[model samples]
Target: MKIIIILGIFLTSIANAGEHQIPTAPQKYLDMQNPIVKMDEQLLKITSRLYKRKCSKCHGKKGDGKGYHAENIEIKPAAFSIPDYMLNRKDGQLFWIMMNGSDDTEMVSVGPGTDIGLSEQQMWELITYLRKEFTK
Candidate 1:
């Protein structure tokens, strides 16, 4: 019984060691894909229009936090052009923020049933545009 338990522990340790080993070059290549080199112009136009209709009231036309309605609000909307703030956030995080606006800030969920009512795909497009435009 002692020998069996020792062998089991030894085998488990070996398996774990192998699992943590650095992956091969081919494996790394398969893990990642090339990023989209260019934005789709048609999608850009659609998202731009959506931004104008929904976001321009708070984020401004250029996403610089200078929208016409911004003066009345206590908390200023995020300036999307700021590289420091834009770089740390992931696309998924941005999507979540758009779908469920920050609790402390004036930003509200622009998703369905809300005043702005943006679809999931539309929010994704807006995220893509913001990431592309803001992140260097």
Candidate 2:
């Protein structure tokens, strides 16, 4: 049993060894800026809940991408807690992923028209929250 567990962990590590291959956002999205300039208490409260509900299952509460569903998914969720990872990604890139999702991964569209129904402002707020709370 111990061997099995160790092997599972090893395989998981191997799976996550490579850098993520997220596509670039369009020029328009790349040029966009985050409108939310602040991370007040109220915003944190709201965005935390949003993250817990929609993201924690895969991204982990600590933004480590080893949440409940991470083991089952083919592609791992982004690990925002990694040093300099979040800082390197542009705000618009994050926003585009939240809105349109990735084609190669299971991440589905969560924009306004989708079932998740996240508005543009809400996505931006989540981006702000992620940058503030997860970036190492």
Q: Top model by lDDT, which number?
A: 2
List model 1 lDDT by residue over 1-136, tens digit each.
9999999999998787455422223343334332433557887887778788888888888778789999988667778876576776555566666767776567788887888888776777787777666555
Deviation from native of the Cα of residue 4 in model 1, angstroms: 75
Residue 12 error, candidate 2, Å: 18
Clashes of each: 0, 0
C-alpha lDDT values of all predictions: 0.70, 0.90
Q: How many backbone clashes does candidate 2 have?
A: 0
> Candidate 2's C-alpha lDDT?
0.90
Q: What's the CA RMSD of model 1 in angstroms?
A: 15.1
lDDT of 2 by residue, 43-73 (tens): 7999999999999999999999989999998
C-alpha-based local distance difference test score of model 1? 0.70
For candidate 2, give the lDDT of residue 97: 87
Q: Each prediction's TM-score against the native? A: 0.65, 0.84
